[model samples]
Target chain A: MRLISTYLIGLVFGLGIMISGMANPAKVLNFFDFAGTWDPSLIFVMGGAVTVAFIGYRIVLARPAGTPLMEAKFNIPSNRALDGRLIGGSAVFGIGWGIAGFCPGGALPAVGTLNADVLIFMAALVAGIFAAKALQTLTANRAAKATA
Target chain B: MITEFTPYQSLAGGVLIGTASVLLMLTLGRIMGATGILAGFFRPMSLEDWTWRAALLAGMVTAPVLMLAVSGQMPPIQVPISKTMMIVGGFIVGLGVTFGSGCTSGHGVCGMARLSPRSIAATITFMIFTAATVYVVRHVFGG
Candidate 1:
């Protein structure tokens, strides 16, 4: 039941990315190009998503404490501290997003579009994820060494 | 040099995405964090829970195919860089997603929905850098 529901939702999310022209790299770039030929179109995507989510979450969270909904805690983040990783890593992500106008969600469907370039991008993305894990380990090791 | 901004289409799509996230949360009791799901191999945790991830991924990939089947045309996808540049950009994106803890979906959609301060801060920081990168790449480098 849980898996089926998630799959259905993923289908809708995928369709949304495709229909929103978010699969289009140029359109996404225009959104980020605030100084250049800017396109404010993509902002609406966020607005729509956030509004729905804001309301949907509130209602879901407000469900009775003993209900099935409350049995499984909502997987929302509770951390409030502003940290270096969150900011610095996000800045790095921004540079990448600005470069390609592709994020994980919007970019995935491009593969289904049979976009060869997108496939290449996906390959690199996988490699990068592995690299990130390695980098995280290295940093942690260095920290441990310093403390020792 | 650019196309008309399709406001209605984007908004409708956004609603679909938001609804999808809500549905996932309601049923699975999990946040639909795209990067984490996609980067399955990099999971520092156990991989026993591959059922939902695989199912969701299959649905996501099938989407464009379904669109083609329905309309007999592929969606317009514009690439901003060359093949080599794309590979590099993808790497950056993948790395950043892992280091940053999430991408557009996790941070932008789910996190924002839940009103996490970290997500808000991350979104602002990334938006600044993204806009700046576009400015620098397009204006300074003449791309």
Candidate 2:
């Protein structure tokens, strides 16, 4: 039952991406083109997402403990620092998005459409994730050793 | 009707995406972050986690295919880079998500929705950098 709900949620999210034309990497790329034929659709998409999110967060956070379907709380995060990792990572992401026109959320549906470029992007993305995890582990070990 | 996606459509999409993220969390106790979902492939299987993650991924992949089936076709994509560039770009984004601890959906959607300051900063940084990079790559380098 829980699995079903999760799948349904993912489906809705993907549908949203498709309907918003976010599945089209070209459309996303056009939004970045400031001096050229700039498309403002992404702004609208962001606006819509933000609006829904505002209300949604309020309702979810108000709940005591987890929601009906899950055991854990609605939101969780350990780190809050605006450090170099955040800045550097974001810069790299931007460069990639600007060049490929595919972010993670937008890339999933693109792959479904059998776009060769999206598939390649997804592969690279997976590799990057593993690389980051390895670095994170190494950093944690170094910190632990320093403390010990 | 405008050929382009209108505000109403975008809003509707946002609602759907937001709702799905919430619902998935409620059902599975898992944040609907794509990086986590994709990473599950390598993790030691607890049957429960695997089941939902697979379902989540399937749903995402299938939704667009279903749309294409029903809607007949979508507009042609306009990627500016060659296949190699796209691959490199993907790696960069993947790296960003890992270091930032979340991707756009994870940070911009779930994290921001929770009023997380880190997420907000990350989202802004991601968007600004993305815009700046796009400007340089497309306009400056003409790629």
Candidate 3:
């Protein structure tokens, strides 16, 4: 049941991307172009998403206790501090998106649609995730040893 | 140049997607994280968790087909890469999602609203990497 619901949610999300014209790499690439022929349609998509999310968060958070699908509570972050990891990661992601014209969410539908470039982008994205995880584990161990 | 959809179209679509995500969470108690869903395939199938993941992925893949039947208009896809390269890209994205702990939707939509530091960081990182990769690939490599 849970799986079915999740899949439906993803389907809707993908459909949203497609209908919003985000499934097209050219629209995304145009957004990044800035000078040549800027496309600001993404701004509306972002705005709409943020608006809905803002209201949704309020309703969800107002509950005496709220739990996401897997957990028993909303995983709200308590810390607001910025660190090297944050900055470094953001830099890398932006560069990739700007170049590839597809972020992860936008990439999935593209993959299903069988866009060759999106597939390449997705592949590299997975590789980057693994590399980051390996590094994270190593760093965690080093920090643990230092503390010990 | 990619043609832009009107604001009405974008908003209507956004509403459906956003509402669907909320409905999924309320009904099933799960966040629609794609990387996590895909990862579910690697685990034992007997686990109840696998059932939903498979269903969710199926829906994603099939939505286009359904749309084609109804609308008769599939967007033009121009990836400009080989199948091998695409696979490689997918792996990197998977790895990034794992390390980052969420993809753009998970972090950009959910995390950002909740003021999650990690999500903010992840979102920013993801965006930056995207931009840099584009620059390098399009300019440095001249692809």
Candidate 4:
């Protein structure tokens, strides 16, 4: 039942991405092209998403602690750090996003299109993720050696 | 570069996304960040964790079939960049999202909704860089 619920949620999220025109890299790129053919539609998408989520979060959190339907706890991010990795990583992501126009959310649904380009991008994305993980491990081990 | 302003559809889509987020929060008490979810699926800690993630991914990958039924056409997916660029950009994005601990859905939407300072900072940084990169690509390099 939980899996089904999660699948349904994922479906709804993907449909939302597709309907918002975010599934189109060209459309997303146009939003960033302020000096060229600019489209302000992406702003509305963000605004709507943030606004609804803000309100929904309030209502959901208002429920008593440990009252979640299917889980024992609310697995929310508790980190409050504004560190270099966060900022630097975001900068890197932005440059890539500007160049490729496909964020993880946007790209996932587009995978259904079965386009060769999409497939290639997905493959690269998976590779990138694993590479990042490996890099992190290397850095952590280096730091541990230095301390030890 | 030609694109139409689609506020209504975008808003509706955003709402749907928001609804999905809220539903996830309610049921599993989890955050709905696509990259994090995808990443977790790859490096799952347990069978329970892996199953839900797989389910979500299965739904996401098959969503276009739903679109075909509703919209009477496949969702338009246009990659403006070359295959080489796709690999480069995809790699950078994967690394960034992993290090940053979130992407648009995670930081731009859910984190911002929660008024997370880190998320706001990350969002601002990414937004600025993205616009700058676009400026360089479109005007400077003329790509």
Candidate 5:
């Protein structure tokens, strides 16, 4: 049941991405190009999403505790510290996004298009994720060794 | 060339995305961060976790068919960059999201809606760099 719900939710989210023109790298790139043909459309997408989500979350959270249908409790992140990793990672992600105009959210749905380029990008993305995990482990090990 | 501004469709689509997020929250109490979800799908913590992630991913990958039904055609997807650049960008994006702990949907949409200061900072940082990168790519280098 949870799996079915998640799938339906994912479908709706993907459809939203498709309808918003976000699935198209060219359209995404245009939004980033201020000096060139800047399509202010993406901003509206964010605005609309945030507005609806803001309202929806408040209502959901206000419901009695342990209210979620399937889960025992909400799993929202509580980390509030502004850290170097967050800023650095976000900036790095931005550079990549600007370069390709393919954020993970946008690219996943595009995979259905079966474009070779999209497949290549997905492969790289998976590789990158593995690389990040390796890097994380390496850093942790180095830190432990230093402390020892 | 003036880029086409699509206000209605973008907003409507955003609403749908927001709805999905809300539904997920209501049902499983999960955040709908694309990178995070995809990562979990690949390196699942448990069988129960994997099942939902797999289901969500299946839906996402099959969305083009849904588009075909609703829009009467597969949504057109254009990758303006070269294959080499796509790989580079995808890798960087993957690394960034893993480190940042969220992407646009997680940070830009849900985070902002929840009014998280960390997400706001991250969003601002990424948006600045994205614009800068675009400026460099399109204007400076003229790629």
Candidate 6:
């Protein structure tokens, strides 16, 4: 039941991405390009998604188990305080997303479209993720050694 | 801010995404964070833990194919970007998601819906910088 629900959601989400013109990196770039050709369609997409999710989240959270129709605990981020790390990271991330015109969510299911650029983006993204994880681990180890 | 607005299609697609998000939350009790979920798949996990993720990925990968099969056409995706640019951008995104704790779906949709201050801060921070990057890329660098 759990797997089925997740699969169903993913299928629709992928279709939404494709139909909304978001699967195209060019369309994404257009959204970012303010001075040049601008496409504000993504704004509507965001508005619609946010509106529905806002109400849906409330209803789901109101359940005794913290999520409706599920027996598992909610996997929500509890941190509320804004910090330098979050700001700095997000700032840099924006640069990447703008340059590449691909966010993680939009990038994943896009593989189905069988676009070379999407494939390249995904390959590089995987390498980049592992690289980042390694770099963080190295930095932590170095810091620990210094303390020792 | 306004240019080439795709009102109906965008709204319809957006609603679908919202429904997916809500259903995922309600059924799986998980945040629909693409980056985290994908990353978690590569890492080691018990079979029971991995099954749903694999099934979800299968669905995602198959969605466009099914649409194409039924509709007789698929959307075109053209990205005229360099290999170096791809690697660099991907690296930054990976790092950023880790530090920021979420990407579009996680922070923008779900987190904002929950009224999370951190998500709001992250979203605003990314939005400002994305705008700046766009201006510089298109205007200054002519990308």
Higher-ranked by DockQ: 3 or 4? 4
Residues A1-148, model 2: lDDT tens digits: 6667666777787888887767677778777777766877777776677667667656665667545446554435677798998877877777777777888887785677777777888888888888888989999999999999
Deviation from native of the Cα of residue A46 in model 3, angstroms: 0.9
Could you tell me the interface RMSD of model 1?
Answer: 1.7
lDDT of 1 by residue, A1-148 (tens): 6667666777899998898877788998888877777778889898888889889877766766623342256665667779888888888888888887788888886778778878888888889888998989999999999999
Model 2, span B25-115: residue lDDT tens: 5555556677667777556369866877777877888787778788887634556668888888888888888877777788888777777
Best by TM-score: 4
What are the runs in model 3 whose C-alpha is more than 4 Å off? Answer: A64-81, A142-148, B35-46, B80-99, B121-143
TM-score winner, 3 or 5: 5
| Second chain TM-score for model 3 | 0.83
- Model 5, residue B16: distance off in Å is 0.5
Better of 1 and 4 by DockQ: 4
For candidate 3, the docking band is acceptable
TM-score of 3: 0.78
Clashing pairs in 6: none
Q: Residue B112 of candidate 2: its Cα lDDT?
A: 79
DockQ of each model vs. true complex: 0.72, 0.58, 0.44, 0.84, 0.81, 0.65
Error of 2 at A97 (Å): 1.4
Runs of candidate 1 exceeding 4 Å displacement: A65-71, B41-44
- DockQ class, candidate 1: medium
> Model 6: what is its DockQ?
0.65
Candidate 6's error at B137, in angstroms? Answer: 1.1
lDDT per residue as tens, model 1, B1-143: 38568899999989988888887777666677888788763463455467677878878888989999999988888786888878878899888888888888888988898888888888888888888988888999988
- TM-score between model 4 and native: 0.98
Compute each candidate's TM-score over C-alphas.
Answer: 0.93, 0.90, 0.78, 0.98, 0.97, 0.93
Q: Is candidate 4 or candidate 6 better by DockQ?
A: 4
